[model samples]
Target: MKKTVILGTLLLGLALGGNAQTKTPVGSIGKNDPKAKAILDGVSTKLKSLKSLVANFVLKVEGGNSKVTDSQKGTVYVKGQKYKVLMGDREIISDNKTSWTYSKDVNEVQINNVDQSGQSMTPAKLFTNFYDKDYLYRLIGETTEKGKVLQNIELTPVDKSKNIFKAQVDVDKKAQTIVRMKIFEKNGNKMSYEISSIQPNATVADAMFTFDAKKYPGVEVVDLR
Candidate 1:
């Protein structure tokens, strides 16, 4: 269960970074807010034009009774339906059909089938139109960060039973890219990710999304499929 939760969280973050090209229709939650749709549409348009992307990010987690804060840095590479993510001593590689999660600390790798449900969250759906379904979103306000204008948008899950209560995204107006995102969980945990750098249309080979077991000596392989 712990691994499942961790994988779910990581996949959610990847989904947020995924791509969407079509215009998202206003859902019930955001039907009254045209401004939010407009801003999100702009982001979608920008993401649709990119063939691939590489981003360096900082993740921060806060909350819980101890109020302890933790921070980590990671990198993500996305090309169409494929992605590779590295964080700490762990790496996730997926070719949109199969996924391999390797943990250097444990010297193990887990293989699993890709989830393709209608409600599935994956890297390929991140920036695209994933937001159009599960959550109700609206433009909250705007702010300036490092001289760049940012539009802040808040999203609330239509299903109250979701572990995530709300999410806040800060989109860079000029670049039409997401610079930051904060997710608030029902369990009182708050997680935030800031994109420190981004390279759009990066050249990434397909092999980069597959795990080669021979490269890792004596690593245990767990097949969960």
Candidate 2:
């Protein structure tokens, strides 16, 4: 269950992830849909203005036969480079320097130092110019869901070696926010995140990003930092 929760979080980032620190020239990237770029840029602009965010979402995992194997509700808090994700029986917290993965079922917490050297996407980067160079995206037309019209965009990774082959993002046209994200892996596993609610510019404290052992009395600490 620990591994499943961690992998779910990683895939969640990929479903709404991007690395903006490194610059990839526009011209160097392959041809993309202009309409999709416009919508995505608008989302990035709106999200960049937020100082902090709290979001609730539902994660649905499907197997090779397209059967819903698992479903979980999760919440994410993001402020700058700090983030905390809670899904089912586990919670992952990071303060940009240190990270703690706590498993409530087993009463264990694994600590590790944040790897600044890697290109892995952080939760905060999901709102930046994440789709600019990493993927070739195109508008997949609009659909009406729950009375709101949503624009769908399909994204294919620029690098072919990635485990994720493609992803689809559904953006609420009027709200200019992501409504849903579906990721397709090479192994035929599908994971989708449906945004339930979002609180932009929420009042968040710095202390929320770090884990306090006191909160979980009997948790065994496995510090690998």
Candidate 3:
């Protein structure tokens, strides 16, 4: 489903320390301009303070007759080498090495390595290094970021042919926080997730990031191994 891509990619952006809603203008970077490098350098720094975050997402969809929509509230915990996402009946857990997605409805969990490379907008590894040689970046106009006027940053998939979702990330120059994000699918469906509230360096439970099948009785695992 296109909506799933939007959702998955949105989560991917979280791992990248980038936003998909605000598009930063790239008119300034070209050929061999140093301004381009400067902009990315700033993005690298802004992305470092990010440790843990929790957000609520609202998903809406409408078509001819079948209308599907839902809102998911979840918390994302990231500490040193661990990450966990708890959303309704879906849970994604990773220990900076292995990753797994568990769905309560189906009682199945899919597992994968945390490499996150070339799997779409999921650049979890890139979080530690905000630069992906293939993605392009530039500063757009400033609107409102983290309650202050900051520089807007835009990122585009360099290898468009394999791009997962076109993104626009709004970054607060002063607060160094990503305020809003918009993700557009290659199929023309647009999904936007805004950071209504952001809490940084929040204490995250260590156990939540691990998958303990014993914790959920009868829950099965689907090894995408």
Candidate 4:
């Protein structure tokens, strides 16, 4: 379940940000597919224009047999580099500098400094520009559902050693929003998330991204930094 929360955070970040910068060159593994670029650009433009966003999502984890082993629902709020996520008994709050991960089941909160190097899978990088660096993207296909057309794009990592084998992103062409993302892992596990609903340019307060320990009277705070 910890993995699920971590992946959920990545998806939320990726869904809300745009404009990527990469330290390492994309090299030969990356492709210049115009069709895929156009679709991704549209989604990126739409997300970047939003001042803030609130989204409800459904996450499903599938086993090697292609059976869904676990399913959960969650909510995420994003404003700039800050985000707050709630999934089951866990809540992760980040203000782009510090992060607080609270687990209700354990009655503990873990505090740590945020990763800003842009090399790691931090929420800021994923939301802003992580795709620009290590990914080679191509347009896979297109489909329609509920009268909405969606363009599907597949992204493969430039580094073969990465645990994420491939990432499939579905964008709603008309809405210019990401509707779903499916991540295929090297371990034969599949994780997918669907955006059920979203409110763009939401009025979110900065304090929402910070964890107030005073609210949790008896919770243990573990400062890992």
In angstroms, give how far residue 18 of model 3 lies from its true place: 22
TM per candidate comes to 0.85, 0.84, 0.72, 0.87
lDDT tens string, model 2, 1-225?
A: 234333333323213333122222333246898888999999889988889999888888889898889888888898987898888898888898998899999999999888776445667667677678678988866777667777778888888987888888878889998887888888998887887778889999999999999988988999997
Give each model's clash number.
Answer: 5, 0, 12, 2
With candidate 3 superimposed using the best TM-score fit, by how many Å does residue 47's alpha carbon deviate from the native?
A: 4.1
Which ten contiguous residues of candidate 2 have the minimum total lDDT? 13-22
State the lDDT of candidate 3 residue by residue for 1-225, as single tens digits.
Answer: 432244443332221233334553356433322444565566556555567544444444323243334445555555655666666787777776688788889988888776655443332333444435656666555554234664555566666784334555655556555555555556664445554455557767777677988878887777775
Q: Where does model 3 exceed 4 Å of error?
A: 1-40, 46-70, 116-126, 144-147, 163-165
lDDT of 4 by residue, 112-159 (tens): 888767655643444554576778887766666667676677788888
Q: State which candidate, 2 or 3, has the greater TM-score.
A: 2
The candidates, ranked best first by lDDT, are 2, 4, 1, 3
RMSD of each predicted structure: 6.1, 6.6, 5.5, 6.5
Per-residue alpha-carbon lDDT of model 1 for 1-108, expressed as tens digits? 133333323322211323322343444543536787788888878877889888888777778663538778888888887888888998988898898999999999
Q: Candidate 2: TM-score?
A: 0.84
Ranking by TM-score: 4, 1, 2, 3
Scanning candidate 3 in windows of ten residues, the lowest lDDT window is: 10-19
Worst 10 residues of 4 by lDDT: 13-22
